[model samples]
Target: MAKGERPKDSRRLSRKKTKQKIFFDEVCRMTKLVPKNKLTTYGAIARAMGVDNYSRHVGFALGKVKASDGVPWWRVINSSGRISFRPKDRVGEGTRAKPFTSLQSIKLAGEGHTFTEAGAIVGWTKKLHDFNR
Candidate 1:
């Protein structure tokens, strides 16, 4: 499919599912470009895909990626440069459970991304990968 064009199956599926797949695919592709130790926000990925208001959709897409997908899902974060996943215990009923935030933080730290004492990414604006530029 052409970039920015919806998939052929879009017409047959529910609107939400179709958009989710498109946003998911775009996020997966763009995430592969983020270099180690650098990061981008869910909002940044959404903007890159030309969906400025779909930042949460970017998060949804990342949640669906499997380890075998090789999408570097860990490189994406919330706009505040914080890990977006809540602890499993804090998740409400019917919500998707997430792996521990500490695990995500550890992985980012291993890649050389620094964090503040309170756990937000340190100097996040400076560390963001500006794909648009």
Candidate 2:
């Protein structure tokens, strides 16, 4: 290898990390556009970023954001307009379990969002912000 040359594998890894950082930054920017009283879906953000159907990547990027960064991570939810919490584990005793209360729901409620008994957002037509529009 030349004195200034990096290993091919190391170069590829560096480029991958750089791309991930760019994706994460774009996700944060889109999340910021969701106003206090409005919401957007992970799929929507992915679409806005020109990567339609990459909702899980959107979620992964948002998960990397720190609470103090002011990105409003809670404003993003599943495509069905519900807070997407990981399901609680059920041990072998045959007892039902529930996931912890969603902080995203709490934040959205404080912004005046209403939910159905099953927890889908109500009046979604008016509340869901379309950044592409």
Candidate 3:
């Protein structure tokens, strides 16, 4: 699919047994559908994929994507509308020496997404793209 193109029929993922690679691919596809200046929660993607408990897994799959893959991984945030650290970032949630000024924040800011002084995206719910469309 072209960049940002939603899967023809994957508004929600199938629950039937599938390979882990397929699950990862589905996550990538769903993520591609998020608009440029919009956002979505990891949990929202998991729920849309029929696995509400898999938000962390969603984060993992997104983390594995390369920049060339056309997945806007920065458009995803935690349910609280805050940018989160990946396990590999070596920074625990509360241990960031600085506020949310990571590269991801810069990217989101470049796209017109606003954030709080502490780094939480402002008007997050209004910017969310639910993929059902």
Candidate 4:
């Protein structure tokens, strides 16, 4: 079978599983990075942690982690510096895109990070670290 193909009856884990595992590990590590409110991209973590060809795998891994874990999964985003939109909520629950963005912005603001009218970081993370003294 090719890399993308899966055989029947063997219960083989998909290739995505491996990348997800790598992603999970990276997320766990990222959770430990200092100065809360600092955002890291999927590509940043992938390259820092040595995962090859698996930026989306980082997002997938974060989605799978349990909420009870307190993993700060919101900090990971695309390379273009945008946070991931929340997955559609369960029945009767409300959800919104850019949920993490607001939280991140608030946290960064407490640390004196600035944002434009469109609500971007505007070098907030670096500023936070610098302002921390």
The lDDT of each candidate is 0.79, 0.82, 0.83, 0.57
Clashes of each: 0, 0, 0, 0
Give every collision pair in model 1.
Answer: none
**Candidate 3 local Cα displacement, residue 23, angstroms:** 0.9
| Model 2 per-residue lDDT tens digits across residues 37-88 | 8888898899898999899999888877887889998888787878876333
Cα lDDT tens digits for candidate 3, 9-100: 66544433346679889999999889898899999999999999999999988889888998889899998999887554432245456532
Model 1, 12-121: lDDT tens per residue? 78777776677678889999989888899988888888889988878877888887999888788898878887343133334245423455676788988888866689
Candidate 1: deviation at residue 20, Å?
Answer: 3.3
lDDT of 4 by residue, 46-102 (tens): 666666566776677677767687776655555555445545312233457533334
TM-score of each: 0.74, 0.83, 0.75, 0.57
Q: Mind sharing the TM-score for model 2?
A: 0.83
List where candidate 4 sits over 4 angstroms from the true fold: 1-11, 14-23, 88-114, 124-133
- Candidate 2: clashing pairs of residues: none
Ranking by lDDT: 3, 2, 1, 4
What is candidate 1's TM-score against the reference? 0.74
Q: Residue 105 error for model 2, in Å?
A: 1.2
Arrange candidates by TM-score, descending. 2, 3, 1, 4
